[model samples]
Every structure is written in structure tokens, then in C-alpha cells.
Target: METLLSIIFIYIFVENFVLHRFFGICPFLGVSRKMETAIGMSMAVIFVMTMATLVTWLLYTFVLIPFNLGYLQIVTFILVIASLVQLVETVLRKISPTLYQGLGIFLPLITTNCAVLAVTLLAVRLEFAFIESIVFALAASVGFSLALIIMAGIRERLEMANMPDVLQGSAVTLITAGILSIAFLGFQGMLSL
Candidate 1:
């Protein structure tokens, strides 16, 4: 339970997908302009990240380890993540047309999101147990959602602010991300595990 809590806190604040680890910056910057779209993208990301972690963990433990083919972790994990995203896209479109429409282009773009891949790799690197990996993955996705939501809120406000031309768009977003990263760095000493 303590480890699970630690994973939750770590992923949400300490090792945030965008601020600290710098994963999925493309969508983090591009898709975060509107709160609605941001929420949709975040949801898709959370689903894909969690599923990718489970499938990748299973492949690592059952397939890769058994075959002594750990070297194929990256390739196998990427393939699994890509396929999982596609499957999720199809399922969501079939079951939830509203959500499918809301997510729009971001759903397909998740295939290349580094955060999805990073969580899988980090789970293996940490050698988390099967349950622990799932917990970690879910926690990580929650963290990503938290960050995206917060960023979208900020950007929504920023859109109304009259900023200089040089500090517009990606420039301002990057600066905000940098500040958020610095804030997240404060959590580094919070947990030993």
C-alpha cells in the first residue's frame, strides 16, 4: 500500500510525464489549448497508457523472459502499444461515438506518445510486480491527466492574456512547463522508494 501510494505521488508530481520526464510534449503543447479537448486527449492517453503497461509487462515476463529475448523489449513494447492504441480507438469509436468524436485526431496520435512507452519501460526497469505495474501504470496516467488538465486550464486563461508576440504559443507553453517542472522537482526528496 505504501509503495502504491508512493507510485501515485511520484508519477503525479515527482516524475510527471510532461514536466519532469518530458514525454508527450507534442500533445502536451498542441492539444492543451482547450479544456474539453484536453480532457478527451487525457482520457485517451490514460486508457492507452494503462493498457500498454499491462500488455507490455505481460510480454516482458511471459514472452521475453521465457525466450531470453529481453533485447527485444523496445521493439515488442512499441508494437504492443501501437496495436493497443488502435484497438482502443476502434472500441471507443464503436461504444462511445461522442468520445470518439471528442478525441478526434489525438486518439490516433497516441501511438507515438512517449509517455505511453515511458511508463511501460519504467515499470520493467523498476521490476514492479504484476499488480504493482498496473497500479503504477494507472497512477502514472492519472498523473498525466492531472498535468494535462492543469496545463489546459492555464492555457485557457493565457489565451485571454495579452502576451508579447515572442512569448506566444509554444514559447509560452514551454516556459510554463519549465516552471511546472521546477515545482515538481520539490517532490524529489519526499519519498525514499
Candidate 2:
């Protein structure tokens, strides 16, 4: 139980895929201009990451290892993740046109998002249990969402604050992300398995 809690803490605060590991910076910066868009993307990511983890884990444990096909992990993982993204895109388009429009090109971009791929690959490499991998992926997705929402909130405020001409737009966003990453690192020694 302690190990589980530690994994949650580390993934959410210590090893956040965005602010800490820096996996999905493209959408982190591009789609975070609005709180709604950020939230939508986050929800979509959480769903995709968790689903991808589940599918990949089942495939690896049941099929790949059984047939000495371990070498095909990456290819198989990508196929699963891409299909999940497409399903998510379809659902979002039908359920919420506003969010669908807000997400724009970024929706399909999730297929190529490194964070999703990283979570799937890491879950297999780390040899997590069925439930453990689900939890890990969930924690990572929440961390990504937390980071994105925090950045969106900050950017909203930064828009209102006075700043020099040179430090506008992505310049300020990058600087803020740097500081946020350092803040996450401060969690060092806070939790350990």
C-alpha cells in the first residue's frame, strides 16, 4: 500500500510527465490558452493513457511474452494508442462540438503525443501489475492535466500582468514552465518506495 501511495505521489508531483519529465510540451503550450480547452485535452489524455496502458499490458503479458515477440512492443503499443486516440476524437466530436472545435488540430495530435507513448512503454518496461499499471497511468495523466491547467491559469494571469515586450507569449510561458519544473523537483526526498 505504501508503495502504491508513493507511486501516485511521485508520478503526480515528483515525476509529472509534463512539468517534470517534459513529455507533451506541444499541447501543453499550444492548447493551454483557454481553461476549457486545457481541461478537454486533459480529460481526453487521461482516457487515452489509461486505456492504452490496459491494452498494451494485456497484449504484452498474454501474447508477446508467450511467443518471443517482445521485439514488437513499440509497434503494437503505437497501434493501440493511435486507435484509442481516434475513438476519443470521434466521441468528443459527437458529444461536445464546442470542445471538439476548441481542440482543433490538437485532437489528432494526441496520436503522436510522446507522453501517451511514454506511459504505455514505461508501464511494460517497469513490469507493473494489471491494477498497478492502470493506477500509474492514471496518476501520470492527472499529473499532466494538473500541469496543463496550472499553466493555463498562470498564462491567463500573465496575460493581464504587465510585461516587457520581449518576454511576451511563449517566452514567458517557457520561463514559467522552467520555474514550475524546479518547483516540482523540490518534492525530492518527499516520497520513496
Candidate 3:
């Protein structure tokens, strides 16, 4: 329990997906112009990432490991994540049209989000146990969402603030992300579990 808690804390604040891992920067910069879009993207990512981690972990352990085909991890994980994103899209469309609309085009884009793939790969590389893998996945997703939402909020406010011509859009955003990453680094030694 302590280890799981520590992992969650580290993933969320210390080793955040965006700040630390630098995965999924495309959407982190592209889709974070609006808070609503950011929230929707974050939620979709969280759901897809958690499910993808679980499915990939099972496949890697039971199927690939049994066959000694671990070298195929990347290809196999991508296929699983793609299929899972499709399934989630279909289910959301049928069950919640509002959410489908809110998610907009980003829902499908989840297929290519490196953060999800990175989380699965990290779990495998670390050889996390079943529960630990799930916790890590969930924590990573939460961290991604936190960073996305915060960036969106800041961007929303930045629209009204004066900015230098050269550092207006992507330039300033990247700088802000760098600052946030430095801030997150402060949490590194907070917990040693």
C-alpha cells in the first residue's frame, strides 16, 4: 500500500508525464488552447491509458512471455492501444453523444498519443506487478490530465495578458512547461517510499 501510494505521488507530482517524461507533447501544445477541450482530452486519455495498460500488461505476460516473443512488445502494444481506442470511441458515441462531441477529434487521436504507449512500455520495463502496473498507469494518466488542465487554464488567462511578439504562442507555452517541470522537480525528495 505504501509503495503504491508513493508511486502515485511520484507519478502525479514528481515524474509527471508531461513535465518529466515529455510524452504526448503534440496534443499538450495543440489541443490545450481551451479548458473544455483540455478537460475532455485529459479524460479520454486517462480512460484509454488505464485500459491500454491493463490489456497490454496481460498480453505481454500471458501471450508474449509464454511464447518468448517479448521483442514484439512495441508492435503488439500499439495494436492493442489502437483497438482499444476504437472500442472506446464506439462506446462513447453510443452511450454518451455529449461526451463524444466534447471529445471531438481528439478521441481518435488518442491512438497516436505516445504517453499511453510510454506508460505501457514503462510498466513492462520496470516489471511492475499486476497491481503496481495498474497503479502506475492510473497515476501517469492523472499526471497527464493535471498538466493538460493546468496548461489550458494558464493559456486561457494568457490570452488576456500582454506578451512579447516572439514569445506569444508555442514559444511561451514551451517555456511555461519548462517552468512547470522545474516546479515539479521540487517534489522529488518529498517521499522515499
Candidate 4:
């Protein structure tokens, strides 16, 4: 169980897909202008990533590897991720137009979000067990959300705060993300994972 906990902690803090792995920076910056949009995108990512991990692991473990079809992982993974994103987009549009609208392009962008693909690839590459892969994906999603929400909050405040001209817009957002990434590094050596 400690290993599972370590995996969660590793993905969530020690090696966050956004801050540590540096994946999915596009939506991390593009849609993080508002807390609502950020939350919406994050939730979408969480579901998409977790589902992608589960499906990819199942296919790789039982079907692909068993059939000696390991070479098809990339193509299959992309297809699965894209389908999942489309399903999510449809559900969000029907269930809550507000959030759907807030998500905007970022919703569909999850299809191309390397973080989703990264989790699946890494899970297979590391040869993690099914449960371990699921846990890792969940933790990575949470970490992604943590970063997005934090950036949204910071950007929200920055909008009202008086700052230098150069520090406005993406400039300040990128700087804030860099600082947050460094702050996450403080967790280095905090765990044995």
C-alpha cells in the first residue's frame, strides 16, 4: 500500500505532469484566465486522463501485448483519447452550458493534451499494474488541476493588482508558473518514492 501511496504522492507533488513533467502547458496557460474555466478544464482533464489510462492499460495488458500488437500503442491511444474527449464534450454541453462554454476550445484541446497521452505511455512504459496506473492517472489529474486552479487564482488577483507593464498578460502568468514549479521542487526528497 505504501507503494500506491508513493505513486499518488509522486504524481501529485513530486512529479506533477504540469509543474514537474512540464506537459500540457497550452491549456495550462490558454484557459487559466478564470477560475471557472480552469476548474472546468481541470475536471474534464481528470475524467479524460483517468479513463484513457484505464482503457489503454486494459488494451495493452490483455489485448495488445497478448496479441503481440505492442507496436500499435500510439495509434490506439490517440484514438481512445480523442473518443473520450468527444464524449466529455457532448456530456458537458448537454449538462451545463455554462461550464461547456467556459471550457471553450480547451475542452476539445484535451484530445491533444500530451498529459493524457503521457500518463498512458508512462504507465505502460513503467509496467505499472492496473491499479497503480489508475492511481497514477488520478494523481496526475489532481496535480494538473492543482496547478491550473492555482494559476487561475493568481491571474485573477493579478488582474486587479498594480503591476509593471511587461508583467501583464502571459508574461506574469508564465512567471507565476515558473515560481510555482520551483516551489514544488521543495518537495524533493520529502518522500522515498
Candidate number with greatest TM-score? 3
Q: What TM-score should be assigned to candidate 2?
A: 0.90
- Give lDDT tens digits, candidate 2, residues 110-143: 8988999999999989888888899999999999
**Superposed model 4: Cα runs more than 4 Å off:** 91-106
TM-score of 3: 0.95
Query: What lDDT is obtained when candidate 4 is compared to the true structure?
Result: 0.89
Candidate 3: tens digits of C-alpha lDDT, residues 118-168: 999999999899999999999999999999999999999888889889999
**Model 3 / residue 88 / CA error / Å:** 0.9
lDDT of 4 at 39: 88
Please provide, for model 4 over 1-193, each residue's C-alpha lDDT reduced to its tens digit, 9 standing for 90 to 100: 9999999898888888899889999889998899988888898888889999999999999999999999999999999898878877888789988777866557678888889999999999998999999998999999999999999998898899888998888898888899999999998778855
Clashing pairs in 1: none
Reference-based TM-score of each model:
0.94, 0.90, 0.95, 0.90
Give Cα distance to truth, residue 31, candidate 2, Å: 1.2
Greater TM-score among 2 and 3 belongs to 3
Error of 2 at 18 (Å): 1.1
Where in model 3 is the C-alpha error above 4 Å?
none
Error of 4 at 110 (Å): 0.6
The 10-residue segment of model 1 with minimum total lDDT is: 99-108
Those runs of model 2 whose alpha carbons end farther than 4 Å from true positions after fitting are 91-106
TM-score of 4: 0.90
Q: Which residue pairs clash in candidate 3?
A: none
Supply candidate 4's per-residue lDDT for 185: 97
Candidate 3: global Cα-lDDT?
0.91
